[model samples]
Target: MENVMLRDVIVDDLPIFFEQQKDMTANFMAAFTTKDPADKVAFKAHWEKILNNEAIIKKTVIFNEKVAGHVSSFEQFGEREVSYWIGREYWGRGVATKALSQFLDCITIRPLYARAVKDNIASIRVLEKCGFEIKGEDKGYSNARAEEVEEYILKLS
Candidate 1:
């Protein structure tokens, strides 16, 4: 993957990014997602909260100069957690792995954390390749699945 880089997300990127996140397959694989992915008003408000907040680290994942997806980290229950969304078109191209490697370098916070739906082997593999270790498991409500899902928690020190 050439030209894979992480850059500060801009307002113009939100629409594109939100569309990527709204993919039903991607949302199902991720398990946790916005209550209603199609609501532009809600999507805009959500991105606004993320972009305006100083604590969140937001970045656009560029692949060969095209907007491929996004990788970002935010605090959950006082633990910083990694999360990402890859456009369905970009899946299986190693974009997530490459972009994740670069994003980890920019986030220096130690003992970082991440989670993945138990069946999402691809996402778990990306986190593991980046040096995050599976620490435990927990159940959470998945808005996309409309049910509780088993999630694996990982940690990096």
Candidate 2:
């Protein structure tokens, strides 16, 4: 489990977060990703906006005292949805499961929602393990893969 922990994301964490998201394999698995992962300017601008927003619940996923990735909640299409990213090097070993479990405890908003690429079993398993139930399914254009992909929608109520 690597003593996974979640804490408020700080400005210093942006570089690591950006680097992690740039991983081709991780972004492909996530499916829904920035239009250009390599665009540092865009990444910085995006994070700046997200971090400054008070309505968002953002956290850095720490493992063994190092930044493993990030987990956050934000509104999309009038729904409060959750999302997380785990560095490719730390994939598996239950990092995502532990981080989400801990993160869920800090968030009290009921009927929380989450989504994952249908083919991303690792992410689906993490959400399911944290008590998110499969609610529905939909298809969307995945910028990371540059194609349409099935996405699983889940909720915690």
Candidate 3:
């Protein structure tokens, strides 16, 4: 955790992000993800769109000087929301929590929102550690689970 850092996402980080997000277990835990996690073209296009958008605050997560994942805050449903994906190898080591803490420091938007599949206790814990509180519940079609999944809506103000 002490070695975790966040930096502006660069073009070179996309490949690492792609591989990290493609983990079956990681995707399943995330629940809401791109329809085809293995589609390289789609992944590239998605990153391109994100990188081109100045409104999005996206960063590459560096843990022990290696790209562990990515964290981002963007507008969704007319509200600002935060999201992050950490490689499974970095899980259980406080990587998500630390990365998100740093990212939140850069985001000044109040009442920021975040969501996590209800069963993803690790993500929930990370958000809570970053001062987000569960404010509501929602159900959405999860590409990873291929079903309607329940999620928690958390807010940080």
Candidate 4:
């Protein structure tokens, strides 16, 4: 596969973004809570807000010249943190790690935080590979799964 790259999400990319989001939510329903079609619609609306919002930094993750997923950093709980998702079809290919590392390089910030569902070993590994250290854990509601789940927190300093 071609190397993963990150670029600004443009207006024209919304369709791909929406499709990827649906695929990801369906594939990881246990970790997310957007199983219901209505919930998925709401999720898309939320992403629309993120796409237009100036405060959030969102980028499309490209692999082999195709849109694979998205990476972003946004202010939450008083800290600027990073988060990303790679499509199920592209998992285990190092695309997320490379895209995330590149995203972090572009955004200059200290004490960056990331969270992954406790069961998502791959995501945890990606964060670790990118130099993030586990700091703690918390219970949170996941939209795709429709239940509260254990989340592992990682910090980069």
Candidate 5:
């Protein structure tokens, strides 16, 4: 297995994260994303809120000493939820599964939730591998897809 580790997110990691999110394929798979992924100002503002928020548990994912992406847990719609973003280059190397596993160890909250676009089989698989089960479904506007997208809601308890 690759040496996937999760650590505190730093200012330096933001650029890599920004570039990762700009990938069209990733944006499509993620579906519910920023309306403008290329808007650096919005991206910065968003990260500032995440970094400064005391309630959000955010971590940078490192693989072989390089920043691969990030994982975080935060409250959304009054429910604790988890999310992750792995660079396209790191897509199939088990980076997300291992990083999320490490994150779950630190976040003790139960009944955690996660959502993935219905067609994003890879993401759903990662969630399932980490002990999350599909519990419901939802539909929402997706800026990436530029339309309403169906998604699966998964829960870990």
Candidate 6:
């Protein structure tokens, strides 16, 4: 895989972002979300908030000179953590790992954290490859799944 770069997500990227998210959300719901997409206006609103917020570090993952995915770090419940997603087409090509590694390098803070759905092996592997250790597990409502799901917590020290 070519070097993956992380750059700030601009306003123009919203369309691509929305499409990728819709696809990922649909896939995630196969085993998780019970509600119809029609009832998920709030979910779209959340992404809009991320897009408009200046405090949240939103980034686009660029691979082979194209937008391959997104990665971000933000504060939640007083803790800073990272998260990312790569299009299914780009999976298994190291795009996510490379993008996340570069993102981690830019984070000066120690003890950053990350979380992944318990069943998402690929995401777990990506976090692990970036030096995040599994710290624990917790139950939370995943909007994509629309139900309480087990999630793994990872910490970088």
lDDT of 5 by residue, 1-157 (tens): 4699989999999999999989999999999999999999999999999999999999999999999999999999899999999999999999999999999999999989999999999999999999999999999999998999999999999
Cα lDDT for residue 154, candidate 3: 98
Candidate 2 residue runs with Cα over 4 Å from true position? none
Compute each candidate's TM-score over C-alphas: 0.97, 0.97, 0.98, 0.87, 0.98, 0.84
lDDT of 2 at 54: 96
- The model with the greater lDDT, 3 or 6, is 3
Point out the higher-scoring one by TM-score: 1 or 2: 2
State which candidate, 1 or 2, has the greater lDDT. Answer: 2
What is the clash count for each candidate, in the order shown? Answer: 0, 0, 0, 8, 0, 2
Judged by lDDT against the true structure, how good is candidate 2? 0.92
Better of 1 and 5 by lDDT: 5
Per residue, candidate 2 scores C-alpha lDDT tens digits across 108-153 of: 9989999999999989999999999999999999999999999999
Model 2 residue 13 CA deviation (Å) reads 0.7
> Against the true structure, what is every candidate's RMSD?
1.0, 1.0, 0.9, 2.3, 0.8, 3.0
Give the CA lDDT, 0 to 100, for residue 144 in model 3. Answer: 94
Q: Let me know the TM-score candidate 6 reaches against the reference structure.
A: 0.84
How should the candidates be ordered by TM-score, best one leading?
Answer: 5, 3, 2, 1, 4, 6
Report the C-alpha displacement of residue 36, candidate 5, in angstroms.
0.8
| C-alpha local distance difference test of each model | 0.91, 0.92, 0.95, 0.81, 0.96, 0.78
Model 3 per-residue lDDT tens digits across residues 1-157: 3599999999999888988878999999999999999999999999999999999999999999999999999999999999999999999999999999999898889989999999999999999999999999999999999999999999999
Residue 35 displacement (Å), model 2: 1.1
